[model samples]
Target: MKRSGNPSARDTKEGLVGWVEAKRKPIGTRPLRIKNTSRRRRDMINRKSSLGVALAIYLAFCALPGIAAEPDVNSLPKERQQQWDKIKSGMEQEYNVCIEHCGGKSECEQKCRQAHESRLQREFLKLQTAEAVPAANDTDLVHWRKTSGTGEQE
Candidate 1:
């Protein structure tokens, strides 16, 4: 009878030495029945990378409004533009008041700025709703205020 090269080929005992040899599988090698770990690790990495990319895209889109560039009032419709212009001018008035009233008081200036910004935000939202445009969230008024010469923080 020919002895098979694979000692662990059979579960049943061929002999004591054969049984021991069968139990002693080559180092760094898996049984034929076992799933390949390397392949599973590769698949796991692929899944993780895909999920990371998806999350990045989601965050980027969600932050669009907060990180938006200064809005162009002209981009809005005629009525909406006029409304935004009115709101902006009003905020400008408040800004002048903030600077003048606060004078050199950092605390007072900060409070005034906060109040003015809140009012501006409220009016901006009101204008958008009143306009009823499809793309109503069209302006980043806060960003505009910071960038525009009007009411910009010192």
Candidate 2:
């Protein structure tokens, strides 16, 4: 029977059959039941267990020691500590100068920092070499000079 107003509102036999078909599950398919509260509890437990496992792994890795640890300045030998302090101080001074020169720009400061670090590394290497080599005598220099064909004699 068709009502006069909206076509969708009309209750025809075809519409009745369509509604019945929509409600019916396909052949061989079971109707979906509301998920059990126990199933929801299990899912929550799984999520919690996974989170715990992840946290355990993180802690285990972190506790393994010296990960991303920077060398302590105070632990360095006195001479090395002095050198480090000098370099660090020089970096700050250069950084300030560079900032002033470039109107406080980050790029200039970064360049200044890199230069300072490079100088520090070079000086550190020099110190290491000096530490490794015992004081050179005049005789060694004369011997080397003679062997190398240098005309100058000590």
Candidate 3:
């Protein structure tokens, strides 16, 4: 029985069956369930936990010991602290004298140079004794004398 605008009965049924078959095929088809919310939440939790663990380990290894072992110089024994201050003051005076000698008039330069050299020699001897080391070697002494502008040899 062929209809006017529609095809014959067998043709119409066959066309509908083809359309259903195409829909069943997987070509360009999406999944029934789209988003996996649980997996995404698990991944977020794992990332946060790993970051927290790494931060804790870093602080423990890199920061804790440095904070614990630092000594406050102000809390040193009184005698040691006083000796440190004396050494600091002497160093300051020696530096000023050296600067004046290296950049001043001839008479003032000579006086300052002598004072600076004497103080430096004293300090060198003190350090050598404290460290149980020999005084400056011949080459070192020669270099120092030349640098101090008190070289006796050419």
The residue-by-residue lDDT of candidate 2 on 56-148, one tens digit each, is 999999865543333466656687778777776876687677768877677877787666656666655565554321235655675666666
Model 2 misplaced stretches (Cα beyond 4 Å) = 1-76, 132-154
How close to the true structure is residue 109 of candidate 2, measured as C-alpha lDDT? Answer: 71
Off by over 4 Å in 3: 1-37, 68-70, 74-154
| CA deviation > 4 Å runs, candidate 1 | 1-75, 131-154
Q: Candidate 1: TM-score?
A: 0.38
Which pairs of residues clash in candidate 3, taking residues 3 or more apart in a chain or in different chains? none
- Give the whole-model CA lDDT for all candidates, comma-separated: 0.66, 0.62, 0.57
Best candidate, TM-score-wise?
1
For 84-154, candidate 1 gives per-residue lDDT tens digits of: 88878978897997789877899998788777766777776676556242332446654555655467432
Please give the range of 10 consecutive residues that has the lowest summed lDDT in model 2: 127-136
Colliding pairs, model 2: none
**TM-scores of the models, in the given order?**
0.38, 0.33, 0.25
Q: What is the lDDT of residue 76 in candidate 2?
A: 61
Point to the candidate with the largest lDDT: 1
- Model 1 residue 116 CA deviation (Å) reads 1.7
